[model samples]
Target: MRALRTGPLLAATVATIGVFLSLTGCSVAGDDRPVVMVSTNILGDVVGELVGDEAEVVTLMKPNADPHSFEISAQEGARLRSADLVVSNGLRLEEGLQQHLDAASAENVPSFVAGDAIEVLDYSEGDAAGNPDSHFWTDPARMIAVVDALEPVLAGLDGADSTVISERTADYRAQLETLDDEMSTAFAAIPDERRALVTNHHVFGYLADRFDFAVVGAVIPGGTTLAAPSASDLSDLVDAVDSSGVRTIFAESSSPDRLVQALASEADISVDVVQLYTESLSDADGGAPDYLTMMRVNAERIATGLST
Candidate 1:
C-alpha cells in the first residue's frame, strides 16, 4: 500500500518542543475573561465570531495545518485544561490530539462538540465506510445547526455576556443562511452530469450530500488523510474517473497536492487539480482565512470547475 507519510525528523522536532514546553510550565497568555480553547482553526474562527470580546479564544491548530495530524504544544495543552470552555470538531477528527481532549474532559472542563450539533453523515465507501464524517462544515446549513446548539452553551459561560452572545449568534446564523442560499444559486448552474466530486480524500461527503452532487471517488481510500491508498485503490479510482468523466479533482489546502496531481496525471482521461480549503482555515493573507469566506470561495471554485 502507498502511504502519505510524515517525516520522522518533523515528528521528533514537534515532540522535542512539546517536552520543552511541558518542562518549562509555559502556558498561553491569559486574562481575567473566561478562556475558550478550540481544537481546529476552522472552529476557532467561528467561535471567535460568536464570542467576540466576551471571551479570549485561543486556537491550537495554526493556519493551513492538518487537523488530523497537527500536534499541540504542551503549553497549549495546559491552556486547554485551564479553559472555561473548550470547543472541538469531534467525530474523531482531531486524531493527533484526542488524548489532550480526553484529558481536558477528565478535568471537568466544559466542552461543546460541533459534530454533536449536526446531522452526521457516515463514510459511504473505502476502509472507513460507515464511520461518521467530521467534515460537516462543508454544508452551511449544518454549520447553522452548530451555531444553534453552541449559542446557549457560550451564553452560559461564567464570564460571557449572554445578551451579546445571543445577538452575535443571530447575526452569524443569518450570515450562514445567506451563504447557503448563495452556494445553492452558484451550484444550481452546474449541469447535472457535471455535478460530481473527486477529492484527495473523502472530505466532501457532507458537501455532496448537501448539494446533490455525487461523490465519484477519492485518491485516498478512506475518510482520514492519514490513510494510504493501495495500487489497486488508485487504479480503481482512475477507472472511476475515466467512466465518470470528472475533469476536476480537488486537493485540500491542509494536505500536500502531489498525490492528487499524480492521480490526475495517471488518469486515462485528462483531469485538472483544484485546491479547496477543506479542513483548515488559512492565514490572513491566504484566500480562505475565515469559515464563511472559505465556503464561498469553495462554492465558486466547484461551480466553475464543474461547469467548464
Candidate 2:
C-alpha cells in the first residue's frame, strides 16, 4: 500500500502543481478526461448524475460522514488542487475544508459553490438565528434549482458533452420535482399544530420552510453539529418542546442520539427520539443511499414521527 504523505511535503506538492503544469505545458489534473472534485458526497452524487461517464468525479466526504467536520486525506487534498473543477457547499458548511477549498480557488481552479445556486434560508431563532442555513437539500425545489445551475457549469467543462449534460440534468430535475410533490403531499397529512420539529441541531430549517412546519427547537441550539448544548440550552429547548407539544425529537443519523434522548427525558413529556438522514447520505444497503432516497426516507420518517 502507498503510505500517505503529509505536512510540508503535501503542501509543497500542491503549491508547485501549477508551476509544474506550466513548465510542462500539461494539465494539472494529469488525467486525459476532466476530473471534478466535490467537497461533499451529496453534491458528488448530483454531479455524477449530470456528468455520467464524461468526467471522473472525486468526492471528499464519505457516506454518513459529518460534513461540517470531515477532512480529506493529504493525497486527496493534493488531488483537489489539481481537479478540473471543484464543487463545494459554501456558506461555511464545510468548516474543516474551507482552507482547502480556498486554496483550490486561489489557484484559479473552476470552483462551483452549489449553495450559491439556490435560495438560501436564514435561521430565524435559537443560537443559529440570522446565520445562513447550509442544509438546502431538504427542499427538493432548491435542489432542482441547483440542478439547473449545475447543468450549465458542467456543460462549460472542456471535453464534457453539452447535450448529454443537458439531457441528464433535465431528467434529474423532473425527479426532483416529483420528490417535491411527494414530500408536500406527505407533509400535508400532519396537523399544523403537530408539525413542530426538535432535532439535534438546527438542520431542518429548509425542510420546515418548504413543508410548512415550525422548527420548535434543537438540543445543540446551533446550525453546525460542532456546537454543544449547555445545561441552560438543553433546559430552554426542553421547555420549548414541552410548550410546543411536540411528541417526537429527531436526531441526525451521522451524529450520536444520546443528547437528543437526554433532551427527551429532560423535557418531562412523553417524547420519542428518532433518527433522520439529515446531514449526509448513507452507504449502500442503508435506507438513504442517495439524495432522492435520503429526502424520501426523511420525509416519511418526519411525517410518521410528527403525526404520531
Query: Which lDDT tens digits does candidate 1 get at residues 1-308?
Result: 12325577678889999998876664543446788999999999999999999998999999999999999889888888988999999999999999999999999999999999999999989999999999999999899999999999999988789999999999999999999999999999999999989998999988889899999999897989999999999999999998888999999998888988989888856788999999999999999999999999999999999999
Return the top candidate by lDDT: 1
| TM-score versus the correct structure, for each prediction | 0.90, 0.89
lDDT score for candidate 2 against the true structure: 0.88
Candidate 2 regions exceeding 4 Å error are 1-31
TM-score of 1: 0.90
Native-vs-model 1 lDDT? 0.92
Best by TM-score: 1
lDDT of 2 by residue, 198-284 (tens): 888899888888888888888888899999989999888877887889998899999999998888777788888888998899998
Model 2 residue 42 lDDT score: 89
